[model samples]
Target: MDNLRKELLRPSAESKQEVSGKVVSYFAILLIGGLVGTILIFLTVKGIALFTGNHFSLREFLTGVNWQPGHHHFGALPMITTSFSVTVFSGLVALPLALVVAIAITEMLPSRVYKFFQPVIELLVGIPSVVYGYLGLTVIVPQLRQMFGGTGFGILAATCVLFLMILPTMTSMTIDSLRAVPQSYRQASTGLGATRWQTISRVILPSAKSGILTAMVFGMARAFGEALAVQMVIGNTTVMPKGVMESAATLTSVLTTGIGNTVMGTAANNALWSLALILLIMSLAFNLLIRLVSRKGVR
Candidate 1:
């Protein structure tokens, strides 16, 4: 009778609800995992078709400087080099400035000023990439021509445009990172007789290092993936750049400009797929790096 009474009083409906919730959660996870796996497999198959189907030497594909697809020359080294150069140069220019702005908004400024600045930075992120590209074309290119001489379409022009495009991203993310540093850290530093600058430099910044790195990685990813804007200012030249001011092509610029012109299953199409595969791999690498950094930070 006691057991029967206990069974009668039990919340069986709660257990059923819990089981349903778990089922839904597991379904969602599996669905997403399957989608990602399908995409990866598709890209891998298509990308490798360039080498396997076309019989193009992988070494030549990577190291060759010429990219005349119609004539059977498909050296991608110039585009690869230019991509890295632009990504690196833009990140170099944007990171320090972003750090300064983030610190000012998060740590140094008054709350009201911080509020005002935060929305402004967010606004920058919402602006269309084409608008930025147009501005670079109309305003930045001519200025560069006057200041440095050249057609103003080169690695430097692309770098400047990317710098502006990425600055807001880095700054907003850094601000969130700095703000995520516990108030206790600041209190502890102050209690230890540290000055404001010393506390921020030694305690807060160090604590937020992983997040800052993640922001920079994300910024680099954005710069690397950008196509239309970069193509507009980068001169879309297929040759290796002799200098920052010389016309150069990036993987994205080449792919965007040429992909639509080629027929399906052709070497040209496969080559573009290879470029896209490179981009996918880089994006995965960045995500993996962020996970590693986050794990280390937790440890």
Candidate 2:
């Protein structure tokens, strides 16, 4: 009778556990959704306040070059150009190098060697952004100053720092993508008389295209959103940079520098919110692109 009672209660206990687990999961999901919705609403309202409340022309804000908050000139074109330029140039420099390193680790290195290096890549990712910025400010800046001219705070310097910052992420993701290619695919490629290099270049890389693209987009997002490291190297100048070597401000750098000084509810403050909104929108776009690539990969 005791054993019979225990057995009868077991199923009920299991059912209760399942119910509790599902409740917790649903609660977490709702919590995340609520947080995201709140942020979107707040940023949207504050971002458009500049245009609606202050009556600033949206066209001029998007296309204008001037950013003098004191004189009420709030054109954001220079910051926009600088942000995109840095993100692109950094990704261009980092992606190929990351690809090469990832291939070497995934396809070339012994299993033990690869295991040893995995933590090293993770360590690079874990390093604080401020550390990278300090290194760039102290090391890369001086070298650039010696090689070229000016204060060595410009798009080039920011790009160099961001390349290092994003490299580990890209490399790790690329390695994972390449490794995800089926072993049978490699065996079949080689069985068909393809050399190892040919197998990797033709079969493996093409198969991992979507994953690599996703990695690249993630890297671009990181590069675009980075503030401290970039702010440290970028000169924070409001003018349109004529060249890579010229000092200029990115949207993030400007926000970090200017947000603290301005009074709330002013046009200057709303302008910063607009910049934040731009960043938020771009971040969403990157996430959407990743999801699209992933869906295509699944198909």
Candidate 3:
């Protein structure tokens, strides 16, 4: 009878343990979902309040070029164009170099050489944004000014700073992605009489396409949202940039520049919030694009 009772209690204990695990998992899911939902709702409500309280027209906010709050003009086209241009140009400059560095680390360099240098490269990631901004201000800006003759703080300056900032992130991601490719694929390519370069170009890279693209998207996102570093170097001019050497303001720069001085609930404040809304939208769009690319790669 005692032995029978022990067996019965053992099953009950196992069942209780399983129930506790399920409960814990469900709680975690709910917590994460609630946090994300709350953020979305808050941004939406604050963004809409800008239009309702300030009576600012959505069309003018999106299309107008002049952003002088003193004159009651709140057009943000110039800032939008500047931000887009800086982000695209920076990505174009950084992606190729990042790819080359990643490939060299994984394929070309000796294992000991990579081990010695990997930490040095990753150290770039730990450096503060303010430091990057200061270096750009002290070094890059003056060089550009002397070389091209503008304020020296223009799209070019910003692009150069952002390229350096994003390079570590892109290269790190690319290296991890390349390393994740199955070794069997490389062996198979070699067995088929393909050279090392051919295997890398034809097999490994194609297999890792999704991850590489994801790295690019992440780099672009970083460039898009960068504020203090880019702001310090980009001259902060509220004009549409006509050339790469022209000074310009990005959406983040405008927000940071104006938010401190403007009164809460005013039209100017509301417009800044609207800019925040645009930033959120762009982030979501990039995330969606990454998911689509990943899914296609899986298929």
Candidate 4:
């Protein structure tokens, strides 16, 4: 009787063990998706890069300073300049405004007012960039064209459009960061006779430094990599940006223009891939810096 009961219980226990093991295996597979995706994408892009005369000699590409791919003189500086100028300009325009707006929303406003404004800010995030470009095309581009006297679509117009496009993202991220800090810090400062402004400026801002940097750097990457809205507003000039009002071409724009026009195995294709590789590296560096800063901030 004892042997019969033990044998009957053994199979049931084994069945339960098998089912549990299968469920655990299913979860383990799902959790590794990020690593698998990154590996796959890296392999794909690298393979494409290798086929396009991938070499270490980017001297002509980076230092030659001309970038007329039709004539085979592919200096990337002009495109880089356009990219740098627009991103820097966008950062300058958005940083202070986003910071102020985020601070107002998170710390200064009454809860009722912040609640009212929150939906509008969130809605702005989902608005299509093309719609923003269309508005720039109709309103900002024409206004700038009249004031600056050229194709209304220029670096100035691109910067303004990108600035508006990136604003909500930056502010939302900054607000999250501000809210992450402990309330006790604020209360302690208040108890010590600090004004609300002083408490925020002295105790809160410094403590939230890494969060703030993360937001701006993310905005920088978005502004730098933006293509469609930028191409619509930017006049597609290859020359260096002469002024903020001047037209310029960026790395993303170059990639866009070359996609259908350039041959697959040619130097032009290689150049575009090289430019893409550089952009990827730049974005990676920005993210790493954010991580480093955030690590240091964890006091």
Every candidate's CA RMSD: 2.1, 2.3, 2.0, 3.6
**lDDT score of residue 270 within candidate 3:** 77
Error of 4 at 135 (Å): 1.9
Q: TM-scores for all candidates?
A: 0.94, 0.96, 0.93, 0.85
TM-score rank, highest first? Answer: 2, 1, 3, 4
Per-candidate local distance difference test? 0.93, 0.95, 0.89, 0.82
Residue 132's C-alpha lDDT in candidate 2?
A: 97
lDDT of 2 by residue, 179-206 (tens): 9999999999989999989999999999
**In model 4, where do residues sit more than 4 Å from their true spots?**
1-57
Q: What's the TM for model 2? A: 0.96
Local accuracy of candidate 1 as per-residue lDDT tens digits, 1-299: 99999999887998989999999999999999999999999999999998999999999999999999998898999999999999999999999999998898888889898889888999999888888889899999999999999799899999999999999999999999999999999999999999999999999999999999989988998998999899899999999899999999999999899988999999989999998898899889878987888888788
Candidate 2 local distance difference test against the native? 0.95
Candidate 3: tens digits of C-alpha lDDT, residues 1-299:
99998877776767889999999999999999999999888888777765787778889888989888877788889998998898999998899998998989988888887788679878998888888999999999999989989689999999999999999999998988899999999989999999999999999999999999989989899899999999999988898788988889999999889989898877777778888888888989888988888888788
Q: Where does model 1 exceed 4 Å of error?
A: 1-11
lDDT of 2 at 299: 90
Q: Tens digits of per-residue lDDT for model 4 on 79-158?
A: 88888888888888898898898889889888887788778889998898888878788889999988879787778998
lDDT of model 4 at residue 201?
Answer: 96
For model 1, what is the C-alpha lDDT against the true structure? 0.93
